[model samples]
Target: MNNSIDTKRIVLAALFTAASFALSFIQIPIFPAAPWLMYDPSGIVCLLAALAFGPKLGAAVAILSWLPRVFLDPFGAPMGMLSTCCLIIPTAIIYAKSGNTRAGSIAGMVFGAALSIVAACALNLVVTPLYTAVTMEQVAGMILPILLPFNTLKMVINVVAGQVLLAPCMNVLHSSKA
Candidate 1:
């Protein structure tokens, strides 16, 4: 019985990860000024998995979801995957610790969104210069105008989408368990 349960969890995680992987392709530009900064629903998928399963499995989903991108888009994959992990881990941890309730999901997503904004700013300040000709100063200048609002909007979309899907996802998980 334990083995079966574990198998089900693994299968569920894999399925969520696969869905996230596919969702990564459906990117939309959130900021008109920064068209290169695209938003995807992959992170929301990871959050849903986290709420249904546990943080560990959610983290697994986040990492596995980015595997394809690592090979397909060598230039942006690393930073994108890192940023995604940064976003999902905090959300999962908060949700898991808060008892994984609907309220906890909302709280977790809010916290995670805030964290993502800061992390994006810091990462862009440090890493963006290494990849592009832009310096830290230039990136810093765009933080308030571009990165902040962009990340916030992206996270809002993720949080709202995750909340909207949470019921159906939980229903599926519960039914599967039975």
Candidate 2:
């Protein structure tokens, strides 16, 4: 029985991780000011994985999902992976702690979104200067104007999409267990 459950978890994780990686390729540039800072729906899959399984699994999926991008964009990919984990882990943890209620999901999503934005901003301040020609001051300047809005939008999209699909996904998973 334990082995069966483990196998199911492994299969689910693999599927979610693959879905996230594939979704990462579909980037939508919402903010004109920072076209390079595109939003990918990969985080939604990570959020779903986290909410379904656990934070550790969610974080694992988040990191694995961005691994391909690491080869493609070494410096930028790490930032994306970090920011994604920031969003997934918190949401999973908070939701689990809050008894898995709808309110808990809301709280978790809001908290996770805020944290992801803040972490992305801080990472930009430190790492953006290293890869890009942008200085820390310039990055700081763009925080309020560009980074904040872009990250916020990204999180909002992820949260909304995750919420919409979550109940159905959960139902399917539960039924499968039976």
Candidate 3:
């Protein structure tokens, strides 16, 4: 029985990871000025795994999902992975600690979104210049106008999608427990 449960968890994680990786390819340009800053729903999938399982597993899924990009897209890989982790980890931890309730999910999403924005801004300030021709001053200047809004919008979308999908996911998870 224990082995079966573990197997189910592994399978679920693998599915979530693969789904996220596939979803990463479906990017939508959110900000017109920065078309390079595309949005993907992979984070939503990772957060769902976290909500259904636990933070560690969710994080594992997120890393696995983002691993492909790290090798294939060197320019934005580090920042992309870091930003996604910044969003998923905090939200997952909060949700897990709060007993995975609806309220906890909401709070976690809000907190995680805010944290992602800040982390993205700071990270871009430090790392953007390394990958692009942009200077530190340019990156700093763009943070408030571009980076902040972009990350906020992206996170909000993922949070809302996660919330909408939560009930169904919970149903499956609970049923699996039996």
Candidate 4:
């Protein structure tokens, strides 16, 4: 029985990783001002895994999902990974700590989204200048106008999507034990 459960977990983790990797290809330009900042639903899978399994597995899936992108977009991939982790880890931890209540889920998502936005902004200030043609001063200037809005919107979308899909995913994943 323990072996079966472990097998199920491994299978589910692989499924989540594959699904997230596939979903990363389907990007939508959410913010016109920053077309490079596309919205990908892969984070939804990470959230589901986090809520259903745990933060560690969620992070594992996030890393696996983002790994292929490292070759495709070296800088962007790391940024995406960081942002996704920032959004998911705190969420999973807080949700678990809150006794897994509905209110806890909501609070967790909110807090995670806020942290993701801040982290993205700070990362942009540092990393963007290193990779892109944008200077640190320019990146700082764009923070309020472009980065904040884009990151906020992206995080909001991820959080809302996670909320909408969590119960259904949990049901499918046999998340009663989660």
Candidate 5:
């Protein structure tokens, strides 16, 4: 493991980031329990990194996953890129550092889900009011209650999926350890 930034690592991470971005953009549109909610696989890509690599790599890859989204989307920085950082990086670190045991997987999921809920609420507090007038603010409040829970569910779903799939992924990762 090189301490400083290696070009190889950077390029590989860029590929990971691209995979994540592609996953997020590919909207398969699962039936979300909440209004205007959708499930995506990008978070799984980030978790895959955490399981295969270490915390620092996980964090960096997580950041890469969202940076392009922040730029390309219309509602760009309103949710605060920092909020995404808060949710994804720590979750990745927790999973990476724990060495991906069953207990650690659950703990990581709980941490990530809770963080996502908090960040959504906080960002909505600021971004919601700014994006719309008073009439829209009322709608925003109504929307938040519906949406937050669904986001939490997404975290839970991803964690469970990762836990089930980790062994297979690890096998593939291991074979390439040349």
Candidate 6:
């Protein structure tokens, strides 16, 4: 096996991942949605990691971030487990290349939200058939009604919240020289 990730990268990713998990506990109920798809600045941290490092770091931060959440509160169902992996990596990658400037982060977030919508659509298709009690057609129909819109909402929420909020937070962290 060729295991070659740098130690500093892993440590950073672990820190980011831990931050991601910790952020979940500070929840604000968004409505009737269970587990209430949230606005986590942690995504900002994950995005920052990918921005500072690269996709490998992004994936590590993303996957590691979700593991504890799954054990703690697997939302919607088992199928939704993969949704975590699906949503954040694209967000991470988008943020990484664009972090060269503030405008770049905004542009990347717009693109990232669109990417998240696509990933969410695909996850619905792949997971719904296995988990839903209805026929595949019914599952598709029922889920499409909520899944697409909720995902779009999630992406947009992430993009807007991440850009407006996480950017400043990240800036403060980076500027502190800690």
Candidate 1: which stretches are off by over 4 Å?
A: 1-5
User: Model 4: per-residue lDDT, tens digit, 1-178?
Assistant: 2424486788889999999999999999999998988889999899888887789999999999999999998888998899899989999999999988778889999998998899999988889888878899999999998999998998888888888888788777675455
Stretches of candidate 4 exceeding 4 Å from the true structure: 1-5, 175-178
Provide the lowest-lDDT 10-residue window in model 2. Answer: 1-10
**How many backbone clashes does every candidate have?**
0, 0, 0, 0, 0, 1
Tell me how far candidate 3 lies from the true structure as C-alpha RMSD in angstroms.
2.0
- Models sorted by lDDT, best on top: 2, 4, 3, 1, 5, 6
lDDT of 2 by residue, 49-73 (tens): 9999989989999999899899998
**Local accuracy of candidate 1 as per-residue lDDT tens digits, 31-150:** 899999998888889888877766667778888898889888765666666666666777778777877777877888888778777877788898888879999999999999998999
Instruction: Find the candidate with the highest lDDT and give its number.
Output: 2
TM-score of each: 0.90, 0.95, 0.92, 0.93, 0.76, 0.69
* Residue 47 Cα positional deviation in candidate 1, in Å, after optimal superposition: 0.8
Compose the digit string of candidate 3's lDDT tens values, residues 89-108.
88888887888788988999
Model 4 worst lDDT window (10 residues): 1-10
Q: Pick the candidate with the highest TM-score.
A: 2
List model 5 lDDT by residue over 12-129, tens digit each. 6777778877887765544455444567677777766755665567667767676777767535333524444555566666776777676766677668667866776666656666
Report lDDT (CA) for all predictions: 0.81, 0.91, 0.85, 0.89, 0.65, 0.59
127 in model 5: Cα distance from truth in Å? 1.5
Q: lDDT (0-100) at residue 15 of candidate 1?
A: 90
Per-model root-mean-square deviation over C-alphas: 2.1, 1.7, 2.0, 2.4, 3.2, 4.6
